[model samples]
Target chain A: MPAVVIGLADDPDQLSQDLQSPYPILPVGALFSASERQHLSDQYTPVEFAAACKPRFLNAVFARYPTVETLLYADPNVLFLHSTQPILDRLRNQTLLLTPYLLQAPGDTGPGKKAWPDEKHLQNIGLYNADFLAFTRSTETTQLLSWWQSRAETRAYIDFCKGLCTDQIWLMHAPVFFGGITIVHDPSWHVALWNLPQRQLHQRETTWQLADNGQPVLFVNMKGLFNPDEGFFPHQTRLNPAKRPDVMALLQAYRQQVAAKELAALTAIRPAYGMKPLLPVVRGWRRTATTALTALNKWVDTIYLPALPR
Target chain B: MTLAFTICSINYLAQARTLGDSLRRTNPDYQYVIGLVDKLSTANLPADLVPDYPMLEVDKIGIPDFQAMCDRYDITELNTAVKPFFIDYFYKNRPEATAVIYFDPDIIVFQPLTELNKALETNSLILTPHTCSPTPDWERPNELHHLNTGVFNLGFIGLRTDKIARAFVDWWKERLVYECRIDLCEGLFVDQHWVNFAPAYYQNVCIDKYLGYNVAYWNLHERQFSQRPDGTWLINETDELRFFHYSGYNPFRPDDISKYQTRYTFSQRSDVKPLFDLYCRELLANANEQYTKYPCVYIKPPTIKRYQRVRKAIKLPINRLISLLQHR
Candidate 1:
């Protein structure tokens, strides 16, 4: 099956390397050009940059490609380490694949339990993360577009310039609307930064990730970090970098694997991240390092605001 | 003692909890029963929010109020009852609690319900009728005409745990024994409105007066309300209102929750700016957090049929320009 990775071509360079994934990548763009696409409202809103780019990104992909069998999706920031066999295995018989929300609502009672918050976050975010999307090509995609089209007909503009509708709410019942969607959410597929620190790089799930999910890492979704802003790997969340020795060991014997220029290109992009000399940077962020000490002093006022007591 | 039973399913639980917490605070000793439709769990509500009260969890009665149905057009928990069945499990099993009082999680209490209890003096059953009629002829049970449930609004009811209330409950059981509907063609057989007959047969009191009780929408301006120098609201043609049951708009904020409690609701359009902002803040602070109201939406026609005549061209632009100039 030809797996299609559908995401907006916000960064074409990342889209090119992302094309070399285990499954083929299908880059989508919005109706507007990239320069004109970055629309923002004057008010400070809780909706993030990538989330605002949803309607255009969605319109681009569904309108462009008609034959999508499987979807291997990622955000522009997602970086690959090795061939993602485990993820594909889970999604083998699936029609759609999505990850769990990384940001947990306060007082989330874990899975199969109570989830209550006396107060909803005042942050007016469109609910769903439009990051990675996986779906088979069918009439199902049109159903979503029609539903969204009906909502957008109102032409009401609310917080975040979202036309008063939330992006996340649209997909909440996608399965019910578009039959046969397999929500494959292994943490290995989407290792987000909200749940990871430099120390927990070996294992981090998105949205308050835990440290010990024993499954082998398939693909690393390199999101939530923004620093050098060139290629995919040059983001700021790479405070401490780890060479995937585990992946290196697997590919060491495959001589033909060297031809996968995507891996080499990903490696070459690493130097631009400023964390080039990894061993020293790790020490710099670690305790007893003067960089760590000085950094804390500089950010204390900004970071240490009075918290709403738990 | 009277029993009040309010059921809030998981759908409106957020708004329900806010109302529940406030009611619990205002009437600490009142007989109250909270029935959760599905009995879901939550971290937001503290365990002590409703201390020493019995929580009845049961399957959704599967009834919808026509008004609440339209309310859903605007926008828009459980415990105890689990296992084999809820009624036999909660009512038959529990001995410590004598009566049940159910409050929709949306209601917030502004004052102690000493008045409702006092109203329960003679009758074994007490009910607050819809403060104002949905229409003029709503009271007559024409069947085709919408039933005036205020004649039997379950919003607040008192049931004598003894003969009368039990008999009413017994009657309700037999009626629900057949095609039980909380709301039907022009009547409801559940949601205490079914108990409207309890008063005719058993004995009940109907709370009727627009003295700021229940969902009363005063249309005319001068008739809406009167304010004194001391800031106490005096409903026109009336001396005092027990509690201004905020029914139309948001009851928590001043702009919505009328009766001169605070000017927050209408403050945005007021002459006094700083005071408006400060008063809104205070009202919001007093606004109970338990209820996160989900507003409903409705598809409204652009204009009424009488106004539809304006679509004939000449008066349309003239009216529009006049309205715009007036607005400006």
Candidate 2:
């Protein structure tokens, strides 16, 4: 399988040289109309913009490689620990394949239960992880991609209040809208922070398996591994690095690989698109003050101040 | 054998009767039962008001925490929350019932459920999306609303009495025990939102997109109803009008299409006027005026519930502070 990087770049040559990779870099700007690009850039954050570009990227890939039987989209942060042949094999009957965030329900007994991503969280974010998607060249796949593209173009923003979570939540309708969608329950596939509570990683000689079930770790999503500030995806407290030394070691190795790949310099090359002004990060005293004020406001609103009989 | 049922309090008995009457007329072979959330014994209804159909009270079913559920949930929430429990009751008791179908009390079947029966023959569970196509405008009950509520409408759920369907029901029952709420921020809307995971979680789950299956206010964007010379209704001049879910429709407010929808009025959707008119007459004939007077025995007074909610909200911040300090 050939790997392709879909990115928006001012100078493709500079980006290519910075990575020094064999994989071709497909420019995202050329795929859509100027108005569409403008709308996407205006509405979406850089992270959201990248996620929203998935369908268009896949559509472009299919158009480029017409004879390509199967195309799998994995986030740039993903590290493949095993072959993707099992996923591809599923595509023989299934048109579109999606990996759910958690194969097994989170445990209810332990202290981790409170911190673990519950069904509500899954419902909010999405049942299926948007990081990995497999598409076979079929009518159903075409319908899914087109439908996803339209939704991603407009509604791919991180708004949990309105039940929008950047291209992921929309896949909830994929099975209903487009038939032949197989929700791959294979525990090995697309192991990530959300599912880390249930899945225990262990080394078996050369291969890594989930210690509880002994399922091979096909691929691990390395999101937030490189960023110390984020610490394995923001707002996620389930993963305690003090425990799970196996996962820590794997993440450490992934970090070293990312470091070697000049992650700092490459990430510094700002995309020409989605130049929306970022929200200012609240830190230290400001964060504490904001939290306190919000709490106070809620408290005040909740305070029972009933009017006396007039 | 197929068993079709609807859950409703005594207040909605008129609607349930209308639904039962429609099913009897259309799909006569299928056994229709009214799953009453309100107690018939407590209401002490006259013989005239008692429905012709077999009525199963919620208490009859051995729900472990039945009283607790009634205390927590409102009328609508409690009615919807016990849906899976009814299904489970039938699954265990009704041995002859091969397929079990649930419809909201507010729905009326038009044609025979031939396609549905056929679908249920193979599929473990059959679900109908709230709308097959996109809503034309950002109207009330639009895509975002559907997303907030649920992708599939729980007004109609068809289940084949298989291991998978039983498992699905069991799983659904567990969730609806406490979590079957209309809380959008919590990503729940009664029993409906949880079924969004049905097709994904369970096997042989069919998302039946048949235009005729679940015609309602939300899906009126895609479906238009018209009666043929032969007296059978057709949706979009193609598929037979299998059923119409009169969700948010009130008989008293006859002119309004549905209170929940602002997308279309009777004037705009004259094509669907006859259907609503028919439903209104059917409901009235079934003693709608008398039934609406009966209050559900389960639901508590709103003032007490409101006070409790306010007290919880007041405690929330203080509780959070205490937990934070303890953790530190």
Candidate 3:
């Protein structure tokens, strides 16, 4: 198999020097028109624009490597801990492969004990995690790629109120709209913060396995684990170092591996696209102040004004 | 054997009766029952006002927190919340019933459900999306609304009595116990939004795109109705109309298409006018006026309910503050 990194680069030489990796870089502007790039950048934040570029990247890959029978795309944060033979075998004859966020229902353990990434969270973000998608060369796959590209170009923005979470939520319609969709139910694939409560990780002699049934762990999505701002997924508060020492150990190892690379140089090189339209995130004191003001407004209307006059 | 049922309070008995009459005329082989959310004993209905179908009161299903559910939800929410419980009841009590289908009380059957029954034979669950194509305009209930509400409409769900179907119902029942509400901010719109996971979670689930399956106000953009010389209805001149869901139509406002929609009017879309006219006449003949007078025994008065909700809203901020301070 071959590997390539698709990114936005203002100075390709500087990017190549920063990342001393073997994988060649494919600029995002090479795939889309100038007008299309402007529309996407103006409409969405950097995170959403990156997500919307998935279909375009895949289309470029298929066009470049016409003889390549199957293609697998994984997010940069995902780390492989085991062999990919099993996953490749599963995608041998399938047109598209999708992995759900959770294979089992996050049960109500008790009052203080609650499940993270419950049905409500999944309903908002999406049913399938868009971090990993595998497709084989087929007519159905081509059709899906075209449909997804059209939707991603226009409607790729993070608005949970409108049930839009970048390009993820739109995959909910793929199984219904397209043909030959296989939902991978193996718990070992694409393990992440959203499903940690159900998947317990344990290290074996050489590879990692699920603690309960000893299923081999293929790869783990280190999405929010490495982000200093997010600190292990903002939505997840149920899991901590005290609760699961094994998960913490895994994160520690992943952090060490990332530290070994030229992380500072890579982080310094900013992308050339999607610089405007900042993400709508209210952090630190701003969040606290916003909450305080909302509470104060409600308090005055309900308590103070009611007790006054006439 | 197959069991088809609809859940409604007494106030909607006329609509329920009309639905039952349609099923009886179209598909007589199926057993039709009225799952009453209202207590007939408390209402003491006259003989003429009562429906002729077998009436099964909701309280008889033995929902453990039935009283608590009534306290928490209003009429529309309460009626929809108990849908899965009714399916579970028939699954356990009716041993001979191999398939169970649910239609909202406002829907009328137009043709024999031959395709539906055939699909349910092999598939564990059958679901119909709100519309196969995109909505024409940004009307009241468009694609965004569908996303906030749900992708698949729960007005009609067909389940074959099997393990996967049982698991789906069990999960749905648990979620609807407390989280079933119309709060758009919390990503909930009653029981409809939750079934968006049916196809994703369960096996052998069929996302049936048959334009004939669920024809309603939300899907009118893709479907246009026409009557054949043989008195059968056809959609888009190709697919036969299986059922028409009169979701928001009222007998009093017979001229309007549906109170929930603003995209089309009866005059603008003359094709669907005859269907609405037929439904209005049937509802009136079934004592829609007399049935509308009776109130549901479980629902509290509007003023008291509003006051309770207001009190909760008022306390929400204070409760949050206290919790915040305690955590700090």
Candidate 4:
């Protein structure tokens, strides 16, 4: 499979610098018009703007490589411990391949089965791991992508009440909405801290297995397991080092790989588009004011109204 | 077999009776048990104080030196501390019991616990958080208050007789026996705060976020009240009103919904007026006046003046500092 690294570059020189990487690098600004970019920026938060751009990114990828039948979108944080050949083989027949949270089931001491993201977490966030998703280009997939883009473009913030979380929560109902959607339950796929309680890691030589006899871990989602500035070996506060020392190597390797990328210089670059969150003090003041007003309204209704004559 | 129980001292017997009546009307099939945290006395010259349901005194639940436990804890703390002991008693002794559901004495059941029963089929421990949805901007008992007090409302809990359930009961009992105080600063709010970790540690734990499950003043901002064509109360328009928890409510002051919750009143939330009115009638009919007259055998009844004096004494220095800060 041909590798492609896509991102929006504010500076043309920065895009050239990124092009030095082995993978074919493409600037997102080249794909969309300035007007389209402005519209997207007006519609979502910085975090959400990046998510809403995925459908268009995939469309661009498909247009560039017309022979490419399937497109896999993995978050920058995910590390490929194994090849994507197996996932691609399955995607040949299926329109969509999504990873199940594997939270709804009861505990069973079996190979390649772990329940990290417990049922409560799934209920809170969503069922699908939007970090790792595969979509085979089809009429149904095209329509699904359009529907997802439409939702994400408008309502892609982290608000659960509005049923929005970038693009993840929207995919929760994707199985019902789109046909030929297969939920990949294999534990080797999308292994992260949420399911660590169940998915035991045993590394033999360089290969990581779920249990004594499990499939090779396709990828390890080191989403929050590293802090380049702090130089912490394992950044997950939830995971105890004394207990699961097996993950020490896995996390250490991930940290080294991320550091090797030497993308620290780009960290200070502010987003050219989308909303920045309000200052802490400003947000706190707004909350307090809203609360006080509400209380005043209720107090008037309870105390002042009772004395009123009919 | 399934058993439903509530833990309370003599003061809450009237409320327990009302709860029993609700269960009798709504879910008569389930065995109702009252875990009395205080000893009973027949000194009161009035109608029968006890309800028709079986009463299990806290002492009989096999807590070693039960009197000492009672002495250490105040009325509220004592009532809450004895819950795990009673739950363990039912699960250990009664092998026939498939599940045990607990409700606060103040909660009045409207609809059968069908959703809870359905949840228990798969889950070992089920809990309902104070508010499943976000509460609109309010002064007190907001999301932060719930965070400080507890995530789950221990007033309504369902536990299936399983390994994790039994483990939770043991763990909770250990915590409650020592630290079931209502001291928010100390990170203790009876048994409620400890169970916030239930979903974290235990397996097959289900958080039943059903709108109707435990409707109270705290969650009223999100769950709207309405009535069905058949006259059955509904929550959020669609959800059947399973139970209404009169947590801080007093039947004596029917106009004031709850002393603790200043969020709503009879004049403000007129929809819940009929429900509170029905509750008041039931409580009064259950001889609330006479029942409250009797004191718990374990401890002397506190006088209103003394209680106020003690509270003021505790708050005097804090109040002085606040005034000083304002003046500065």
Candidate 5:
């Protein structure tokens, strides 16, 4: 279980030194060659530059550990509460695995639940959660990763008009086009705020149990939880902590760890190689004013006034 | 085995060609056929460039007084009037066919029709409603319009060679032969409005509300579209977009995906835009510009002589007054 730490900070060395894990922490900058860095820099935004590194990092890991049959790529934000042996056992027969946001559509009855993460919301973001992805080293896995890498290199933004939400949106079709896919419906595998309404995490003796069924909770992806004092928010805005008291202890522990990480110290860090960084205020202002117009122009070129149907 | 066909005249050959091409790409196992409601006259050069699929002209379908029926009904009526006859003809003639499907010439299939085929395995008849869910936008042509025009969009229908389908064909044929007209006053809208009672009248009828099937402008508000990484399309997050009905889409105005409904536009409702571009290219590639000029042999392109125009102008107000009085 060699974990690769992707440093989007100005000084990846300092960031890598701060991390302590049981597995080896391989810094991404040390892994990439000079020419590879130049090639990646020419094509990615700062955020995309970091997001696109996941596949390259995994490819490197696969090369370094040829004996390893299954390689898992989880976002840094995910926290594990149990052993990963079950996930490994499940991945033995499958080439790739993903988890859907919700096993069934969430009804409009719960507090703050009816409004969003609705049918259309899931359609825009993606059907499958990319927080935890595991792949076995095989031809199909290689092809799938390559396909995802190609899409990420070009358009890995949160633009709903282009049907993009980083690399997550593209996985919606992985099952249909890539022969078939194993969508992990196990509630305990990768839980998150989006699916919290349906999945309740109760701390049972020794381990956390999924309240709906007594399946042991493996991990919870703290995607949208924010420390109010720190003032950083996730993309989603509707996660109410008052509704989820059962998971409060887990959330507090993660928040303390987040605070300990001194994320504010590295807030100004930009990727060493990528497009110029625009100020967040300017980016927001320009994005709000230009998204619709740019969408129209892109539609005309690629879809509306296309030379061929795409 | 299943046989599918679209009923059209020479003028609709381009659309028919596009439909045939899509069927070959998506659902190639089924035997595709077309029912032409016109004679292969000498001047119509489209007869030379007919699509590769087997075509059954009106006369070959063995209907009595077919030419007279063609002469009486206008283009819309004629195309619809012959639907049941074609269904009956295929089921009776093609011994190998277990089921028969119908698609409007303007529709293009996108995915394998396993859902429809699966429905046919148990059910004898299938119909798609103008909408499965009520539109939130309260405007003209709401549920009432669908009720008035037809509850079922006759553009697509599936029939198995079972007792119910055979009975349905016999019953539908009897009404269509005489009653297939666009007379709103008589509560008639070709062959579509009559199928509103199919669920009640038949033993094994399925109203297929699959989100992906029979998607069109009227139902666009209900269905949302997203593209997979591999460029395949899905509808409402789960189901694959099986087929789209390009009803009232004008190739000339390529910007507008549909001419009939105003509920969707290119800018706001751009999910269906890719579908429009693909359908347009298919239609144009199938010789849309050239085929549009070749009029149907049976329905004469109405020639407006100056004297007739003058006479109609003189009598227009009197006809309107009489129509208003009769309605009153």
Candidate 6:
């Protein structure tokens, strides 16, 4: 039987609105209520979602499944990246797959020149593409869940933080600490909307034309683009106030084009203003070389090296 | 002859250059081996200056260290020593010889390379790095990560023209020729690090010895060296030194070496410590006439407000950063 997988997320109601993927949906409840978060409040926040949602949801999965291998765990913001075959190809062997995000370069002001010294908030928290993740049934995931359930019940949030969220904090050392399986930052598998993941989006600028041939979008993460009134201006994207009206209107239209599956109309949407070159991916080799490299690299160091090298 | 290193040391004494002269003066034949890569074509060459020694211009082939890889010739801007026409001529006519050594102009060769050729007896692609011990932190030398790669100093390399070595050089050339950019990959812009895994890619690559052949400044740790009992200089362990690279701390004011006192300044090998006495013999013998002004000091209005700030900012962090480079 094909494995049943689920992607979990919380903006409280983010997945609830987009609850119409090809897979079944389960909305994780808020870990802490708004009243519990009264001690510290966000000017705007998901202040207490992960603590409330994750363990409750993951525990439900653990109790039902004898092991995690029978199912796949995914992040809510991820959309299909390549045709489903590329993902299914990965499923042939691996138990876990993940994408690594650009950590704040200890001194990286931000991505570009206007990177003011004051804007330097936290050092790069590279694990940020925390949006796309997969879990398989194994001693590692089981152990991970065991540790997580206990921690989530306590430490709601700590400050060097954008906001206290549970799912990301639990993974502080998943790759190095866990027994090791297959975790990937496969550009073909999933991409976050802004930052380093922005490179993947640029690679796909011409991909919409190619996607019309029944290709799987694999999973495209539009996590940064869901501001309700703002619609979709890309997460962390900055625009001049004068030109903001046109850019926002075009992006909104692009989101509609994506939703409507009007591939040609979406192609007309212009890219955001930025100078970093779109990272290139060698095509045709995606199914063979790209996927193989990503999976192999994960096992060689983190999981196996400890047991063998020592 | 089995092999010889031909350096393209153009206008080396000029501030516009690097250790090309020092590279040649490593031993007796160092200068004789170097030919300046110049603006003129073979047709434009003066009748007496036969192209006996090879010089390269473009960011390709034998010319591995081109303008694209470096930001400066000792902090000078790009496109400084470009000989635009040299590549068109050499690429078309240069012979595929047995071996070639392209040394940096600033490099001072202390001894003849008899053993360097013997090491290349296998006919494999040969290359050298400054320090290959991968260390996590060069600042904290004791840390396990201070493994510095001496690859960036292109002062000396031994290459033979058989199939495997040619294939390797061609691969390095392709990288520097096409994708060379100083801004890429944390400013390790020079495509030298490719040497690290070039052996894996090409069948015949070899990471030459770490200490004796391609020595650089980074390797000196807690142990100091002194003239040995056998008349050879000794560091902590061995004194069988093949080459001593005077990489940094040049005597810019000539008198810095005369009094044995360190000064805050920048000048060529002729002005620094005894590091380049042999190479700069001609220049220094006459230094009393041309560059007679001694005790010259280079003081800049401090970038930081206080002396403590210098230690707090540049000194410690830069040291840590060096250790980090070595670690990887």
Each model's DockQ score = 0.01, 0.27, 0.28, 0.04, 0.01, 0.02
Could you give candidate 6's per-residue lDDT for residues A1-310 as a string of tens digits? 4445452433334223533556555434333355533322331123233333455566567566665453444544444534555555665555455554431121223224333211112111223335555555666666766655554444334222222334453343343234444455343445333332223222334342122243323565445453322211222333232344423443454567566853554345433211223223233433244445444443332332222242
In order, the first chain's TM-score in every candidate is: 0.46, 0.88, 0.86, 0.77, 0.75, 0.52
Model 3, which residues run further than 4 Å from truth? A3-21, A33-36, A82-85, A92-95, A109-113, A228-232, A241-246, A270-272, A275-310, B226-229, B301-328
As for candidate 1, its interface RMSD to one decimal place is 26.1
C-alpha lDDT of residue A291 in model 6: 41
Model 2: what TM-score? 0.87
Q: Write the per-residue lDDT of candidate 2 for residues A1-310, one digit (tens) a residue.
A: 5656554423365565435566667777678777877778877777678778888888889989888888888887788888888777888868888888766445451223455356776788778888888888988788788888888778888787798878888887776667788888777888877777778899878789988888889998877554534321454567776687987888888888878877777776766666764444444565565567667756665565675466
Which is better, 5 or 6, measured by lDDT?
A: 5
- Docking level for model 6: incorrect
| After superposition, candidate 2 runs with Cα above 4 Å error | A1-3, A9-19, A32-39, A107-113, A138-140, A210-215, A224-233, A267-303, B226-228, B303-328
Q: Give the TM-score of candidate 6.
A: 0.37
| Candidates arranged by lDDT, highest first | 3, 2, 5, 4, 6, 1
* Superposition TM-score, candidate 4 onto the true structure: 0.60
> Per-residue CA lDDT of candidate 5, range A1-310, in tens?
4455443412355454555554565666665676766676666665556666666667777888788888887777788889888888878868788777766434442234445444344545555677788888888877777766766655565555444566666665465335325777677888877777677778876688888788888888876665332111233444677767876777877888888877776655545766744224222444344445444433433332213344
The order of the candidates by DockQ, greatest first, is 3, 2, 4, 6, 5, 1
Model 2 over residues B151-224: C-alpha lDDT tens digits? 89989999999999998898888888888878787688898988877866766888899999888999888887
Give the alpha-carbon lDDT of every model. Answer: 0.39, 0.81, 0.82, 0.71, 0.71, 0.40
lDDT of 3 by residue, B1-328 (tens): 9999999999999999999999999999999999999988889998888788999999999898799999988888999999999999999999899999999999999999998999999999999988876567778787678878888989999999999999999999988988888877567889999998886677688889998988999899889888899988999999999999998999898888889999998888999999989999999999999999988998876532224455567767766765554344
Q: What is the Cα-based lDDT of residue A66 in candidate 2?
A: 89
Q: Pick the lDDT winner.
A: 3
lDDT tens digits by residue: candidate 5, B1-328: 8898998877788999889988999888988998987766644464557778778888788887787777667888888989999998988899899999999999999888987898899999998877765555645445445634565789999999998888878877866776677654335678886665454345477777788888888788778899999988999889888989998899899887676776767898788798899888888888888878767777856433334444455556555544344333
Error of 2 at B78 (Å): 1.5
RMSD of 3: 4.5
Report per-prediction Cα RMSD to one decimal. Answer: 22.9, 4.5, 4.5, 11.8, 18.9, 18.2
Instruction: DockQ for candidate 5, please give it.
Output: 0.01
Better-scoring candidate (lDDT), 1 or 5: 5
Could you give candidate 1's per-residue lDDT for residues B81-154 as a string of tens digits? 11112222334444444544444444445556666665555556555544222222322231111121213344
Q: Candidate 4 at residue B321, lDDT? A: 49
Q: Worst ten-residue run, lDDT, model 5 chain B?
A: B302-311
What CAPRI class is candidate 4?
Answer: incorrect
